[model samples]
Target chain A: MTTVAPETVPAAPERAERQRGQPRWWLYGAAGVAAALGIWAILAQMLAGGGGAIQRLASPLAVGEQLASYATDGMVADLRSSLAIFVAGWLGGGILAALVGLLLGRVTLLGRMFLPIIEAIRPVSSIAWVPLSIVWFGFGFSSKVFLVGLAVFLVVIVYAVDGCTRIPGELVRTSTMLGMSPMQRFRNLILPGTLSEVLIGFRVGLMAGWGTVIVAELVAADAGLGAHLMAVQRSYDIAAVMATMLCFAIAGFLMTVVFTWVERRLLPWRLEEQR
Target chain B: MTSKEAEALGKTTRPRTGSRHPLQRIGLPLVGVVLLIATWEVTVWLNDLDSIVMPRPMEVLRALGDLVVSGEFWDDVVVSLTEFGSGYVIGVFAGVVVGVLMAEFSVFRATVHPVVEALRFIVPFAWIPLVILWFGTSLLGKTLLVAYATFFVMVVSAAKAMQQVDPTLTKVGRMLGMSRWRLAFAVQLRAAAPTIASSARAAAAIAWIAVVAAEYVGASAGLGVLIINASTSLQTDVVIAGMVVIGLVGAGVSAVIGWLSRSYLSYV
Candidate 1:
């Protein structure tokens, strides 16, 4: 094996330079203004007997305290429960999506047969499946997994199918010329070629799964972030609600970033391609 | 502001389509669907799956027909459609305005960009409880929730598209003594039409999620309510029927937007 020199890839100094060239202070000023405006809007709405929504938002310090207490309190356990469900559901869905996508992508007959039903069902939001999930699996992990699985399935399949259909004609012809069997070509070329695109689908699916989970938890859930937030809202605890949403937003961002990092590490060659 | 510049700018942008056999383009998806339904029927018959748990295709169709004939179902459809439509239009408006502003302004993009990105990652349906608390199960509440869901998605897409406008077009407009406002409206906006159209399609899907979630909460009339009611009653077929309608409506909206996007491309 020969080592490929890093410099063999295109330089990325321009991207860094562009970032440096952009004015940072002005952007922050505008953002500060926007945040102030947002605060003002909430305050205005709350001050005029807005029923304390603004009053609730006014005490970010209090909310920050609440967040600290929540972090120490059952928040960790609650987050764990939700995260556990999220991981289980996402993994199950990811595996199924990848397998189905590969099969449909590789087999012409299977691709032709399943394309219509898949397309028809693809557009349906996973939230629409909540009722059916509740019916089939009851109000538990099974239902959550099913909903997550369904939502992820559609997105992944679409990307995977597109990836398969995008295989270069010349590559396929060359593989066949080398006496590669249909199965061999699928295993060696089609699947590998589509890996990057399929990974993108997985990322999209994971985020979509988060949204689906919220809906699922809304309908019937004993312990989860969604249920937790709903509890705070019902009690008119606006500060707590906002705090929970903050936690959720932060967690979601971190999760997506982690996935991106993992993708970069796994597909180091992508950097070269991008350059 | 200048017709000559517009015409020249338009000539540089063209769509490239990949090659595919016409038969495979249209025939495969159609044939695949028929075969899938056939397979579904066979599986149900062979396994004797309970209709309550997993309804046969015919049962689902029959249930759909029954619902379509009912006035209540029509009411639900109307409610869902109105919520979806109003929310989508408002979301697109807000998205486009903010996207354009952020793209055109340098400082504005930097400071708020992080916040917008953070908000985008937030689960859309998680806003439902707060919306209910604020607006109290009203039409306003649901519409707000839908708008919240789609707004970030469309804004990000639109803003990125705006940034990608050919600098040369802006240069040409400037050479012709075009004002910044005119250049933005006549050139940047038109150039970003395709991207905006794609974003709108994505926004529709996110909007659908929001509408359904809103209905699932405390909605009195909507397909979401019907599905929940059907589920409770163990009317799996009716629930499936609702799913079918939602999927079809989504596809229909996307197809229309896609056509409009193409039309806009030609116009520009």
Candidate 2:
């Protein structure tokens, strides 16, 4: 493996020289984006000009103007509520999944016993649970949270179990030989080793949670981004609907960036290998 | 202890060889299912809960049987399947075309990246309102929703797969006097096949989720419609039965995708 590293050593200087010109690449990317946006704006304007139901499609400018006004139009309350439910559910599910996964992974026999059932249940979409959730919890905050949390839990548990079970056999053997008890081994090796993988699961789970919360809100909610979307749609306010969608997209992008930053901070030793 | 000592100890303590009977492997999972059913039935019986809140396992099973025997159930199944299948096929086809173009041209990739990245964040469900507005509650609307949901996922996956194709392989093909088009098809596409296939399977699942969601919002016939109707009527058993069908269908779709990939890409 170490010998393989030297094979690419001669190309390093060439790659560095190419990297030095990356700012010019960014300029090209910016131009490309501008061109794409221009095309979209033209298309939207053309569609809007066609009249009839085609007029229902908001022009890009209209959507942008609506997005700007959303902040002052009392939509912030709905955004806050959605974020609250999303965070609460994600954290609740993640913590529970991690704990359960660790326990299950440690007890190999139990893991094996439950693995089939878990897998069978895993393929069932979170949306499938909406009816049952509604029946069980009614149309309230808890139902939405339950639906979101269940989706997150299912995803995170798999990651946690995989992280735990993938501990190197050599590490375990060495620890045992060093007279470290099971508890000590878990604290010193298992926990740290598993955190990196668990964090990855959490990252993915967070996205799943966000998506599920929106779905839950769409199905049943007093207030949230999804509800806001439906409300705007019912009124034939295409611009507001588009603006709401932009909010979701922006929020998702920001959340992913934040999660990734946190992940790097938490697992400083984990180096991402280039494919 | 030294590394050698630890290695020796690890080998000795490792679980024994896989000598269990095949039946035992199958039997355990069956036992687990049976245990779950038993627990569910017993708990329902002991609690004497209303069927509306939580139906008994037996009731749900009966409902499932009845549903399978019903003409309406089959109709809904056919309608949902048609929408899902058509939308998924169209979406995958379009996504692969766009993804290939993007991967082949850096300018195209850069132009599309920002727009796609922004739109990809919106969950498939979030598109329901807009789709319904544009296309109404017709089959076209539902199909478009499914297609829209799957399109972005497929695009991202296919683009990533194409980008990951080894440059050396392309160079090798060129050296062998292969035409550029031939090299792309034979070398690059084949290299990306596994990833593309896996992503297709994932997109299929998203398509299912999207179609069901679209139906929940508005549809004349489908499993989602059945679920919404049953839930509104407080028929928990029917709702569960519908869910079971959805899960089975989803699992079946993925299993088929997996089989196709394994057989077609046996070299991988």
Candidate 3:
């Protein structure tokens, strides 16, 4: 129930001025009109396109039907397998990244010595590592995990290092003044401070990991949502493709929302900021 | 305390080696890299991994040499670069226009922003199938997918930057009797230049992702196709070589863009 200072609220003036200029109902009205128009456009184009631009858009109802059929046709198994690999790989990358980030961030010599090398590796996209991953692990979960790991690893490490480096010097000084040991200081202050940032990294890493997994699966795999979409493409089943895509989109969005919820629950101080 | 614990504790308490010789700084990382490569080489040998499954670094270097001399390597590079350039241009053009319009018009912002945000959740690769169905696996399809992916990210960033423009700049322009249109275009847009430049740089990274994904699903030529083909054949060395080339090209483009932005758009 902590309140932000009035001066700290950047949007307050703008919000007040905006409120005076237009009623809140007008915004809802405009939004409703736009949504109605969009739906009408979509429906008209879908139904009336005997041969036109609207006809080119895939049928949403058909896509939904294909998705239900796909569930009974073994796509559910492929999805489960992909999720298993993604979870394992994401955890592995997160642990490795945090460890490396801590080592580099704490050790001044290591940070200076390896910063350039890390920079070089940072720009090396995981898509660029697909060839190597396949070569090392073959067309298996191993390959997919390796590719996903590469994508998540550097991003998380960079965030972790930044978080550690940016810790306030006065906070460290205060701990020292309290006669805290090195380990005690880290456990109580540094680790907790860095945890919030690391969590942000994990959230972003999950999305990047998913992106890499899909692309890797598309290029080489025999299963997964990407592979399922590919099969639909081969058969000219646009509805199934769209359906599978919708599933992936929903999965990604839900995963993000869940992560945000977890973050809010775990870090109530941040939630306090929202008020 | 145990030696492990002692060493861990000792890390923070030691007299800080805050400054060091240049060679010492360079040497440690060089050794780490050499050790890494040595470990990789030894693991492959001990595991008896076939060269096809896991080629030695030397084998990858040899593949790199072969590709360097071959014309096809350059041709694929050219094709990929052409697609990237044309698609990126169209995407940025569309993105800036849409972003400006959205920023200027609150109605468009409310409706279009939701749609755009929802679309961002869809991975670019998902568009591969749809694009193929509509554009038939042509260069048009690839470009369209690339543009589709890049456009949303750029537009979101640009519109956000416009929103963040200093209100004072607009107010000053008004006080100077500048017309509303001129004030928006000249003052607000100029104020948002730094954000636009940075977002454009980020857009390049996104563009790279989109291009590779576009090629992965269906493309006659490109680094994605090159790597996919190499992997299918179990040509580990060639696959590694392709990766090196892609990494180099991507990094080079980003560095060039950074330099150009820094030099020409100093205001940004």
lDDT of each: 0.72, 0.76, 0.71
Per-residue C-alpha lDDT of model 1 across residues A1-275, encoded as one tens digit per residue: 00221111111244336556776654684676678557756674566464543233425565678788889888888788778777777778877777777777667667765665776676677888887777678889888878887876776666676677678999999999999998899889998877776776777776677767777777776888878888888788877887787778777667766776787788888766745
Cα lDDT for residue B117, candidate 1: 56
Candidate 1 residue-wise lDDT, B1-268, digit = tens:
0111111112111112322677865676778777778888988889898988789998999999999899999998889889988887888899889888888775566556655655665666777777777776678878877777767766766776777788799899899999999999999888888867766776776677678778888788898899889988989999999989888877787778667778768875
What ranking emerges by lDDT with the best candidate at the front?
2, 1, 3
Question: CA lDDT of B34 in candidate 3?
Answer: 75
* Docking outcome class, model 2: acceptable
Instruction: Pick the lDDT winner.
Output: 2
Please, what is the TM-score per model? 0.87, 0.90, 0.86
lDDT of 3 by residue, A1-275 (tens): 01211111122245436745778635754685567556855874665555533235555567679888988987778788778777878888877888788778778767765655666665556776777776667778888888887777766777677668778899999999999999999999988887776776777777677777778777775888878877877887767878888878777777777777777789878656744
Off by more than 4 A, model 2? A1-22, A49-55, B1-19
How many clashing residue pairs are found in candidate 3? 0
What's the CA error at residue B258 for candidate 1, in Å?
2.8
Clashes per candidate, residues 3 or more apart or on different chains: 3, 0, 0
- Rank by DockQ, highest first: 1, 2, 3
